[model samples]
Target: MIQNIINQNAYTALDQEEYQRRYDSLVERFDTTKADLELTTEQIKDKITRHRNLEIFLGELKNQGNLITKFDPLLWNSLVDYATVFEKQKVEINFNSGITIAVK
Candidate 1:
């Protein structure tokens, strides 16, 4: 029964290897997703700060009675376009196992 025992041990070792591989892959994916989320959060915070600064500028211009003239419509339109693009952006990752994950 030593041969049978050897075969069983080999099977167990292969199974353990497979499990480790899957676990490692999952950990890698989790780390990547976490990093992506952190980057996204930073981007959002930056956008908020930019919007706040814009508001402050507008308020100052209003105090000077130059709100309309000092604000270039073209520039404002471009900023709006950029914000729209950012808001509409979607990040999708597809795995070999036919699994798809999206972050927006």
Candidate 2:
């Protein structure tokens, strides 16, 4: 939509009202697209940050020991800051380093 506007040659105004109407419509479309792009960019950045944090958390967990073993309080303390046990036997663990993992 905005591409078609860009392709058009500079406006030579035959009537003042018509020229103003076209110019305003173009500006409105550009503003809407710009706002949408900003929002999408922010969402992408948030996902990238979460992914990086998850990678770091996994690295720390791997360095600790085998995950399948019996629960070790010391290892849990080293990695997790705190945890919340919710209804339905769900648990949300907040790691001291950076990420949160929910389990059931």
Candidate 3:
């Protein structure tokens, strides 16, 4: 959009004062849009990194065989961040990549 606006040379068709106002507004909008795009890109990269890390952790856990059969410190430390016990009926397991699973 910014490139198209610049290529059109639309601002020059207006009077000096109007052209200045329009140009400034367009530039401001372009800057704001650019910043928003950069922020979105950064967020996407962070999500991808977190997903990759989770995959690697899962792979490591898979190599250890059945987790429910025995209590292994290394596997627990790598896969589960923490556990929340709710009364006597429910438990919440928080995984390393911010996923929580509830067991009842």
lDDT of 3 by residue, 2-100 (tens): 465565565546466765676789899989999999999999998997888778777877787765687878767777889999998999999878889
How does each model score on TM-score? 0.50, 0.56, 0.58
Using lDDT as the measure, what is the rank order of every candidate, best first?
3, 2, 1
Candidate 1 error regions (>4 Å): 1-14, 66-104
Question: Roughly what TM-score does model 1 have, to 2 decimal places?
Answer: 0.50
Q: Each candidate: RMSD to true structure?
A: 14.8, 6.2, 4.7
Model 3: residues >4 Å from true position, as ranges?
1-14, 68-95, 99-104
Candidate 1 local distance difference test against the native: 0.60
Clash counts for the predictions, in order? 0, 0, 0
| lDDT digits (tens) for residues 1-98 of candidate 2 | 44554445255325656655776898898899999999999999978977776676677678867654678665566667789999999999997656
Clashing pairs in 3: none
**What Cα-based lDDT does every candidate model obtain?**
0.60, 0.74, 0.80
lDDT winner among the candidates? 3
